[model samples]
Target: MPLFVSMTAGGPPDQVTRRAAHPVARKGINDSPSKVIPTNNFYGNLMLGNQNQGVWTHPYSLRWVKGTGNSSSWGFGVSHIERSQFAYGPGNPNKYFIAPLGITSIILSAQELSNSTALTTDSLEAFSVNANLAVSAQSGPLVTFPLVQGMGFFTGVYLGATALIQTDVFFRTLSGPWTLGTSLKYKVLLEDGRTWLFYVHSSQGYVNPQFILRSNTTIQGPSGFRGSIQVAKLPEGQSNAESWYDWAAGVYPVTGATFGTFNNGSASYTLSWQKGGDTGKTLIMWALPHHIQSFNGGVGAAATDVQLYTTTKGQATLVASDQWVMVEKLVTDMGFTPWTPQNRSVTTLPEKAIVAINSVASSELNQDFAPQTNLDSMYFSGKGLAKFAAILIAVNDLARNPGLAAAGLSKLKTAFNNFVQNTQKSPLVYDQIFKGVISTAGYSDPGADFGNTYYNDHHFHYGYFVYTAAVIAHLDPSWLNQGTNLQWVQTLVQDFASPVADERFPFSRAFDWFHGHSWAKGLFESADGKDQESTSEDAFASYALKLWGRVIGDAALEARGDLMLAIQARTFQNYFLMDSSNKIQPASFIENKVTGILFENKVDHATYFSADIECIQGIHMIPIMPPSTLIRSKAFVTEEWNKYFSNGRVDSIPGGWRGILYANLAIINPKASYDFFAQPNFDPSWLDGGASRTWYLAYAAALGGCT
Candidate 1:
C-alpha cells in the first residue's frame, strides 16, 4: 500500500508529485525513529541544539543545560516555580502573569554525558519525548530519558553507565538509603528550603549501586550500574506527600507511555507502564485542574494535600492511578440550521429580520467574491469564502429567499473552486520533510500568512475553508462528488486533525488531547513553550470540523470534533475564559476576563498584532457561530462585556473589532446586538472581511432577538 492514502477517490496526488521544499529546515530530527510525528508539542525544543528552551510538563519544567549557565555539565536541568516566584505586570489588576525560570533545582546527568556528547531525540509521541545522550557522534546512548508531561517522576534509564547528580542549589542534608520494595529511596534537603526524593531501582534485582555524597552539591553513583533513577519534588507543608509517594514508589521505576481513545461523548486516556517490580502496584501521576474536574468515578482516592501549582493552569492534584476518563456532552445538537441557546432551529425569520438579511445578502453577493477570496494568504482567503457562505446560508435558511441564495451559492462555488483546483495565488504543497500540507507563501517569506508554511495556526487558517465547504455541501449535496471537491477539503482536514498517525500526516497535529486544547506555535523554540492566542478561532476550527464531518456523513470524524469541542470548552473555561467565579487563575489577573495569549510559562493579556483592549477581547469572538454559545457562556460574555466593552466603551473602538464585539454580545443581549447590526445606516467598516451583517443579524435573531 502507498504511504499517503486519500479518503476520497480523486484526492491529493502522491507525495512524490506534490512535495515541495520548505524554507525552515528541521535539525537533529531522527529519521523514522517511530511511527508518531509530533510537530507542535511541549518537547519541540529537543530538536534544537544545546541552548534549548524549556519543555514544560506542568508543575515542573526541564531543559538541556549543555554546560552553560549555573551548571557546568550536560544534563536535564529541572526547575519548579512557586506562586510567590511569579512576576506580574504593574497595575491593581495585572495585565500579565509570568513564571520565573533558571532556578535549577538539580541536574540529572551521567558522568559520561557532557557537552561533546550528542543529544538527540529517538521517538516523538503525542505525550512523550524520548531524549538520548550519546557519548560521541558514533557511539550508542549511555542514557535514555523518556520525558512525559504530567509525569510525577523525572526518570532516567541507564545502560551500565555511572550516575552523576549535581544541584545549583547546594544540598543541605542527605537522608536514607532505605529500601522500599525493590527500590532504594533517599531524601535530599536543598539549601533553598526545598525537599526532593530520589529513588534507584535495578532490573537485575537486589544489587545495590552505592551513591555517595561527594560534596555539598554533587552525588556520584557506582560505575557500570544498570538501572533507572527517579526524582520528584515534595510540595511544601504537605505531611502526607511522602506517604503517598511511597505507596506508588514501587512502580516509579517503570516509566509510562500514554495513549488516548475517544468514543461517543466520552474520552479516556491511559498511561500504562511496562510491568516491573510489584505487578499490583499503581502508577503515580499528576492531574491538571481540568482533568480533576472531569475525572470519572473509577479512580482511586486523590492525594488532596499533595498538590503542586502549575505555571498557568492552576493546581495539579496528585493522583496515584493510571487511567482517566473524561465525559463531556458533545455538540451533536448543532447542524445546518441557525442554532439558538434553546437548541432549537430557526426556520422562519421575522419580517424585519428577513428584510435586513435579504438587503445585506444582495449587496454582499453583487461584489466580486473571487478577488476577495482568491488571495495568497490562506487565512484571509478562507475568511473571505466563509463570509459569503454565512450570508448565503442566512438568506436561504432564515430569510427563505431561494433566488438570492442561489446567486450567492454560485459565486461561492466559483470562489471555492480556485482552492480545490490548487490554483490560488499561493498554492499548497505536500511538505514531505514535515509530512503535512503547507502554503508556498512562507517558502518565500517566513512571516507570510503568519508562517503557514512553517505550521503556525494551521487550524485557524484551514478551518474557515472547511466551514465554507461544509456550507456548500449542505446547500448542494452534489458538490461532494464534484471534481475532487470533497477530497480537497479532506486533505486539509487530514493535515490538521488526522484521526490516526500515519505516513501522510501526524495524528491531531494542532490539537493537544493531553492539554485539553490546541497549541498554535509550530516549529519554533520559545523559552515559554508552545502558546495559543485566539481561543475563539481554536474553538471555531473544531466547530468547523464538526459541521464538515456531519455534512460529509463521517460519524467518527464528527464524534472526534464533538469530543474536542467539549474538551476545549472545559479547558477554555478553566484556563482561558476567566469568569469572576473562576478559581484557576490568579485573583489579581482574572479581572482581564480572557487570557490573551496563554503560553506554558505565562499568560499575557494582549495580542501579538495589537495591544488594544478590543483586539485582545474581540479576537476571541470572531466568526461567532453555534459553538460560540457553547464555549463562551452567557455569563462569561456578560461579565466580559461589563468589564471591558460596557458603559459605551465599545462605540469608541474602530474597525472590524467593533462588529465582533457586538456580535459576541448576542450571547447575552441578543436584542441589542441585532439592533446594532440591523441599523438603517450600518457602517461597512465595522464589519470584518470575514464577517457579514446578514449572519450577525441571523445569529442574534435565532438566539431570540427577532422582535
Candidate 2:
C-alpha cells in the first residue's frame, strides 16, 4: 500500500516495473539541504534543540522551541463553515467545507519586536515558510480551487475543465446574496485607463451571465466620482441565496482599462462606454474615472435604440462630473440627479476621504493572492508559510511552462515601460507600481487627503518589485535590449535598494516597531535592538544577492543567501508550537498567522487576538523562499528532491496536510521531471492572475530564456 515508483523514464512509472521503498524511508528529513527553520527566536539557542525537554512525538509533530505548548493541528481548520439558522449539529448535520491544509506560516518584521504582543505594526517586509514544513508531510491539492459563487436555478455552468477564478473573491456573500450566477477573470482587460466606455461596453457579455462584479478601479475621488461594479446580487436585495456566483473574476478595471499619455501630454485614444446595461455611461481619463452619467432617454443625452436591462440596485444611483453638480446620488447617499453632463458635475472627493477609499481598495488587493492575487503584497509579511508555497508554485510553473515564464517577464517589462513612459513627460511625483498595486490614500469619503501621496514608504517595495522584474529581465537580456522598461528597471533597483531606500543602511528596508517578545531570543545587533528581521526577505535579499551574483557570480553572496532559507527553517522548527502531529499551531485566527512573527520565544508568548485568525489557516511559506532558490542551489538531485517529486502517490496524506501539497513537492525537487508536469489534470500553462505570473516562471524554468 505504501510502495513508491522511480518516475525516471517519463510517464507514470509502471508500478510492476518501478516499485521501490519510498524516498522518505530511505532518506531522513535532513537528507535535504535547505529547510524553513523554527526557533524560540528564529536565530536563537532553541534552534540548537538544547534546554532538554520531552520530545513530543506525533509521528510528524516537532516541538515548538524548547516547550511552549502543544500543537495537534497545523491550522487544519475550516475556512468557510456552512451554518444554518442556528441548528444543533448533533443531528442537524451542520458541516464545514474546510479549505485543505498543506501550508504553514511564520511572520517577520522589518522593525524589531518590542511589544509583548504579536499583531500591531506599521508596515510589512515580506513572507517565508518554516524549513521543517518544507521537509514535513507535504500535503493538500496542488490544483488551485475556484473562488466559486453558488448559483441557484442553475447548477454547473463553470464546473467543466475550463479555468476560472474561484479563490480570492471580489467580495464575500456574508449577507445579501445574488440573483444569478457569475464569474470573474482578471486578464481580460488592459491597464490603459482610457477605455472606461469600451470596457463597460465589453462587459455586456457578462450582464447575462448571472451577476458578475468588477471594482471601479478608476479611483478618482471616492466622492461623486461615481463608477459601477456589479456583484452577483440577489433579487430585490434579498438576503436569501437565490442567485449566487457560478464563477467570478475579480477584475480591477483600473489598471486593465487605462493606458496613459505620451511625451506630448496626450493619452491613448479616449473611450466612451455605455455603462451598466445602457442605463448609464462612463468617461475615463489618464486611466482613472473622469466621469459617469446616466441618460434618462426621454429627457437628456439623446436616445438609443439599444434596449437596456437595468439593475434594480444599479452600478451607480448617481453619476458625477467636474462641475460638482449632483446630477444623481446613490439612492443610499440621498441625492438628486439630471440625465445630462451639464446637470451632473461634482467636486473631487475631499482629501481625507480619497485616502481612506484607496487604503481599503489596496488592502483588498494585497490579500487577493490565492491563484490570482499579487504574490508580493504589503499585506503579507515576507515570513509566512503560504507565501513561500506560492513561490514554490511559481517555480513549478516555470519548470513546466515556457510561455508563462516569458509572459511574466514580458508583463513586468511592460509595467515598468509604462511607468518610464509616464515619468518621462509628467511630474517626478508619479506612482511607480505594479499593474494593480495601490499605495495612494483613500478617497471614498468627504475630507480625504489626496496630496501626501504614499510615495515614500510605498516606494520601498520597489526594491523587491524591481528584483522580481530583474529576474525576468535576466531571462531575456533582449527584454531590455530596446525598451526603456529595461532602463527604468535598472534605475528603480538603484533608486530603492541601495543607499537611496534606507539612506542610513542603503541595503535594508527595515521598518521600525516597539513593544515586543514572544519567548523569542536574539543576539541584539544593536543595543537598542535594531537588526535585520524576517525570513521572507528572500524576495528582497535573494534578489539583491542574485542580481549582484549574476553580475559578478560571487560565492559569498550565495552563502549569504542561505541565511534566508536557514532562518525560515528555524522559525518553523523552533518558533511556533509544532505539536505531536506535524501541523503548525496557529497563533491567531484573524491575523492569518502573520502576527506570530513578532515573538522571540514559543511560550509565555505575547498576547494573542481572537479575531485575527480567518476561518481558514495555512503555513505562510509561499512567498519567502520563492522557488528561485531551487535553481540557485543545486540540491534538486538529492533526497530533498522527493519534496517536489512523486511516484504518483505524491498525494499520500498519511498524516494531515493540505494546499498544493503533493504537486508542489513533485515540481520543486529535481528528481520530479516533465512527466510530472505533463499530467493533463495539472497543466501549468493555464493559471490565473492580473496577468499570469507563470510567464515569469517560464523563464526561470529554461522554457525560452538563456538558462
Candidate 3:
C-alpha cells in the first residue's frame, strides 16, 4: 500500500490548503473582574452534550479500505513499506526484502521537519515516543514487538520480547537513535522450583544487530535498567571493557508514543480501542485536537514513498444535510463507491443535532406567520407603517423551513393588499405647514403635546414601513406590492421633496442629546423633559425623506429629498456632528437654554441615532450605497426593526408600533420588510396582543417541523 512506487526522480508536490478564519465575536470591552480566563477553556470546556457538531476531513482518504478490521486493501495513499516487501540489509542489493510489513511509517523528506516550524503542534512532543511510525529505520532488520521495558536516557535499552520465544538480539541507542543492535540478553524465568533458559535478541540503530545470547538457570532479571546503569558522559576515569559505550545524556525530545514498524504490513490493518481518561484516552485526545474533529474522526495518517503527512475533515459537517453531500464527493473523488445516507443522523454529534432542530424551528415560524391570514394580525401600524414593518421583517431565516417561509410570505401579501386598499380609500390626506399634531403614540387628549408635525423628523416614520416590506419581498415575492397599493407610499414620500419650516421634522431638533431644559435623545435614551419631542423631529423627518426617494425609484423624488437633506444637514450640524467648539447657545425663538444638545459615543449607539438620519436619507437619495448603511442607520423606523433584538430577543416593540403605521412609504413591498427584520433573535413573544397570532403563523410557516 505504498502511496508512491515511482522510479521517477521527483513527483508532484503536496497540496496545501489555507483556511481563513471567520470573524467571530472579538473580545470587546471586558466588563468582568481582573481574573484571566484561560484561552484553552474555549474548547476544553465546550461540551457537545452526548452529541457532537459533526466532523469534516481534509483531503480525505480517496482510496477506500475495501475490507474489515484485519484484511483490507487501501490501494491509494498506502505507506511506503506497504508496497515494498524487502528490507535494507548490509550487503544485500534489494531494499525491498520483506519491506511491506508495517501498519504505518514515519516517512521524512530531505528537509527534516524543524520542531519550531509549526505554531500549533500537538502535545505528544513532550512525551517519550512519536505515535506515528513512518520512516526508514536507520537500524537493521524490520521487526517489532510489544514494548516490555524502556530505561535510561541515550545509550538506553528497549526490551521487546519477540514471539519466536528464542534468544535474539535486543535494541538500544546511545549517541544517535534507537535501532537494531547486534547484542542479545539471557532472560531466565523460574517456574515451580525449576529454572529456565531464554535467549533475548536486541536492536539498536548504532550497533550491529546480528547477534544472539543464551540463557541459563538464573531466574532473576533486572527490570529497571537494561544495562543502562549510568547517564551519557565523557569518562575521566574509565575502566570498562568497552569504554566507547557511554550512556546518552538526558533524552532531548521525549517520544512517548514512538512508532517504529507497526509490524503489520500494508496489507495488514490494526484495530485499537480506547476509552476516556489518561494519556491515550480516545475522547480526551480527540477533543484536545479540535482541529482533528474538523475532519471526520480518527488520526488520519499518510505513508507514501515520497511523503508522510496528516489531514483533517471539512466544514460542511456542522450542518447535517451536507454530510451526505460530502460523503458523495468523497466517493467520487476517490474513485470508490459512496456510503448511503443510511443512519447518519444517529451517528452525528450533538452540535449538528441542535443546529438541525433550530433551523427547523425558525423555518416553521416564518412560514406560518408570513402567509395572508398571518399578516391580518395587528402587524400593521395604526400610528405608522414604518414602525410595524420594522418589527415584522424577520422572516428570512424561517425560509430554511419552506412551509414557514411560504406561509409568512402569503400572510404579508394579504397584509400588503389591505394596506393598499385602506390607503387608496383615504389617499393619505395631509394638512401641511408643520402641523405637529400627529401624535405617533396615538390620538392623545388635546393637551397632551407630542411630535405632531409635518416636518423632517416625522418622516423617520416613513422609512420603517417601506424598508420592512422591501426586505420581506426581497426574501419572498408572494407579496404583490405593485400598482395602486403603492400610492399611499408615493404621497407620504412627496413630503421629503420639500424641506419643512419646522426644524422639528425638517430643520433638525432632537438628537441623542442632553439638553439642560428639554433633553430628548435616541429612542432608547432617557427623556428628561417636555420639549424633548421636537429635538428628534428633524432627524426622523430627514430619515424618512431619503428612504422615500429610494423606494419610489424616482430621480426627482430623490433630488427633492436630497435638497431638503442638504438644508437639514447644514442646520442640524451642531445638534448631531458638532465641531465641539464655540457657539453654545439656544434656539433663536425659544431661549430655553438647551443644556445637553448631544451625547457622542465612539461606538455608534448614541451618535448613530443623531447622525444616522443623514445616512438613511442619503441612501434613499442614492440607492447605490451599501446595504449595511441602511441596517446600521438609526432612522426612527430602523430603530423599531432593531428593537426585535435590543433585549436579545425578537418581538414587536410597543412604543414604536404606532409609528410603524405611517412608514410604509420606504418599503419595496410587504414581504420585503418582514424578511430583513427577522434576524437570528426573532421571537413571537415580542409582540403584545399578536403573541398568539404570530406564533400560529410561525407554526404554519415552519412546515409542521415541530417534532
Among these predicted structures, which one has the highest lDDT? Answer: 1
What ranges in model 2 sit over 4 Å off?
1-412, 420-438, 441-464, 478-507, 511-545, 548-619, 623-659, 667-677, 682-707
| Candidate 2 residue-wise lDDT, 1-707, digit = tens | 10011111111111111222211121212322222111112112112223111111001111222112121211110011111111221211111111112111111111111222111111111111112211122331111111111101100111111111111112222122232223221111212211011011122343322223223211111111112222222222332222111211122111111111112211121112212222322211111011122222222222111111111001111112111110111111101100111222122222332333233223222332332222223222111222222232243232332444344444444434434443211112212221112222321211112111221222223434444444544566555556455444443333232211221111222211001111212111111111122323323443443343343333333222222223233333322312222223222221122223332111111222222111011122222133323221222212323322235443433221212232223234312322233333543332222212222222122221111
Q: How well is each residue in 1-707 modelled by candidate 1, as lDDT tens digits?
A: 11112344323644313664556555655657334457787888887544367898878898877776544767777888888989999776799999987777877788887768877776676677777777876788787777877877777777778787778778888888988877899889999899998888887664566788888878888777777787889999889889887777755423344454555555555445553435478767778988887776666354355899999999988887666555666667777556665755567678888888888888878999988899879999999999998888899988999888998899899999988888898888888777788888887787899988888999999999999999999899999988778878998998888866777788789998778899998877788889999888998899898888788887667767777888899999999998989999999999999999999999999999998999888888887887888788878999999998998999999999899999999888989999999888899999899999889999888887878
Q: Give the Å error, residue 318, model 2.
A: 66
Which window of 10 residues has the lowest lDDT sum in candidate 1?
A: 1-10
User: What lDDT is reached at residue 315 by model 3?
Assistant: 16
Rank candidates, TM-score, best first. 1, 2, 3
The per-prediction tally of clashing pairs is 0, 160, 159
Task: Score every model by TM-score.
Answer: 0.95, 0.29, 0.26
User: What's model 2's overall lDDT?
Assistant: 0.23
Cα lDDT of model 1 overall? 0.81
Per-residue lDDT for 288 in model 1? Answer: 91
